[model samples]
Target: MKIILNGKEKEVADSTTLQLLLQAMQLHPEMVACELNLNIIKRNKYGSTQLGEGDCVEILQMIGGG
Candidate 1:
């Protein structure tokens, strides 16, 4: 399956949930936000959210420096 991640095209397993994707990328869910195919996925639902083929994922990191 093919999906666009952070504006880059990549191949991923079908029915891949958001939680698994983050883990594979070494990304911590608590430190960033994810937009799944243009929809905002709540933190609580990350574990259940599934990513399908052609899905676009936009991950944004939260900055704390002042």
Candidate 2:
């Protein structure tokens, strides 16, 4: 399946969930914010949120600075 990740085209496995995607990319869910199809996805729902073909996904890394 193909999805638009951060404005770029990406090929992912079928039936890939947000959690799986993050793991595949070695990203920490707690350190990033995710949005799917223009809607923000909650952290608790990462395991349940499924990505579809052509879906727009945005992932932004969260940085803490004082």
Per TM-score, the best of the predicted structures is 2
TM-score of each: 0.90, 0.91
At residue 56, what lDDT does model 2 achieve? 96
- Model 2 per-residue lDDT tens digits across residues 1-66: 999999999999889999999999999999999999999999999999989999999999857788
In terms of lDDT, model 1 sits at 0.93
Residue lDDT tens for model 1, 1-66:
999999999999998899999999999999989999899999999999988889999999967788
Residue pairs in collision within model 2 = none
Error of 1 at 51 (Å): 0.7
- Please, what is the whole-model Cα lDDT of each candidate in the order they appear? 0.93, 0.95
